[model samples]
Target: MVISLFFILPIVSIIREIGYLITSKIFGAKKSKITIGSGPKLFHLSVFEVRKYYFAYSWCSYDSLRNESKLAHIIIYASPILSNLLIALLINGLLAYELLGLPNFWNKFVFYSFYFVLFDALPIYYPDGQPSNGRVIYNLLRYGRKSDFERNDPQIDIKKTDEK
Candidate 1:
């Protein structure tokens, strides 16, 4: 249980971020930072940062949020989910074909990878008042205001987004 909570979860997050990074680059967005953990910085690698927790969360920063098209924002926000879902499907496909015989741990990791896509993408606050990706997207579509979908000031809810 501990291993699943700490190791597998972070791995899943990192994998998802890699997908976002790739998609962001493809879209010609400016990359600012990619953090692989929470807490104090332990080291740095160009645009990447490694922190103490290293397993708590993975965050990606980009300069592509302002004034972009609604489709672009949706792609960026959904990149992680799309990426993880693809990986999960591919791995399961291979497993079904018997082309790969991964360990039980890896099998479980694949399942968790798919699970976290739904979990993280759910539209709910994370105890810090920050909205999830789903919420942000929801607000963007619900309010019918493209200009309100800023990354820094995401439309977490309809009431808040409608104010401005």
Candidate 2:
């Protein structure tokens, strides 16, 4: 369980973020980054960042898309959920066919993957007010844009600087 929580979960989270990064790039995001974990910065290489709490939480961000469209935005938001679902299905299929060993570890991995998919696919706002991917997709389809709360919310501007 400890290994599943620390090792497996973080790996699954990273995979989920990669889904976002890939879809965002495919839609022509000017800049895309994946930050795995939270808290103080540990190290960052190009588009990947590892934080002090390397197993706590992870997220992906990107600048505005060059080929921006409703469909693109919807896909970008849904990518993580889809990725997790796909992984869970693949692993489950392998397990069903007895094509993989270590059934216990694989089962835990599949469980966590599906766990992520369920929550991410739920249309609800988090306690911090961030909307889940499902909520974002819902708004896109129903209102043709982000909800008014999102549009009216203050956004932080993160900029890179060159230091001598």
Candidate 3:
């Protein structure tokens, strides 16, 4: 139960992103969450980033994480990936558990499986299967770093990143 609860924390933390976007738009902060829509994605990207970071801080308020650092925001941006993977693994684990002749809460398994599988189909993802959010952007930028070089982030200007 304790182990299940610990892993559950990360999955549940995704709500932070949802709240902040809603917060910025409803109340307006760094800027108005919406734009004139010049038919360009960059406009939307800017708006979304602000809202995301805003909600990310909301996560902090929720005792979700210590703070919403640039790196943390990147993780928050890639949260859906973690969440999607978490759900898939959970479903697979549950199914495997059943196959192994163990028992779990059937109602919970059925409910989570359907939602997670559907969420896995959102309009995200870059050329790679990962979402085109801060975390994957960070990964692409810091592609060849050593394993110890851990804090990869896209909060830095992507335009300044050099391809090796």
What's the candidate order when arranged by decreasing TM-score?
A: 2, 1, 3
Q: Please, what is the whole-model Cα lDDT of each candidate in the order they appear? A: 0.72, 0.82, 0.38
Over the stretch 1-164, how does candidate 3's per-residue lDDT look in tens digits?
A: 44223333323334334433443333323343332112223323644422223222112112233443444444444454455455556666767667533244433443443454344334344342334343343554456321111111333222322224
TM-score of each: 0.78, 0.88, 0.29
The best candidate in terms of lDDT: 2
Model 2, which residues run further than 4 Å from truth? 147-164
Between 1 and 3, whose lDDT is larger? Answer: 1
lDDT of 2 at 136: 80
lDDT of 1 by residue, 55-156 (tens): 876778787644366677677778888888888888888887888765576688888997878876897666655567776667667774432323331222
Clashes of each: 0, 0, 1
Per-residue CA lDDT of model 2 for 1-164, tens digit only, reads 79987899999999899999999999998778888877778899999988888888888877678877889988988899999999999999999999999999999999999999999989897776667888888888887876312221122432322111
Better of 2 and 3 by TM-score: 2
Q: Tell me how far the alpha carbon of residue 14 in candidate 3 is from the true structure, in angstroms, after superposition.
A: 10
lDDT of 3: 0.38
Q: After best superposition, candidate 3 residue 25: deviation in angstroms?
A: 14
Instruction: List the candidates ranked by lDDT, beginning with the highest.
Output: 2, 1, 3
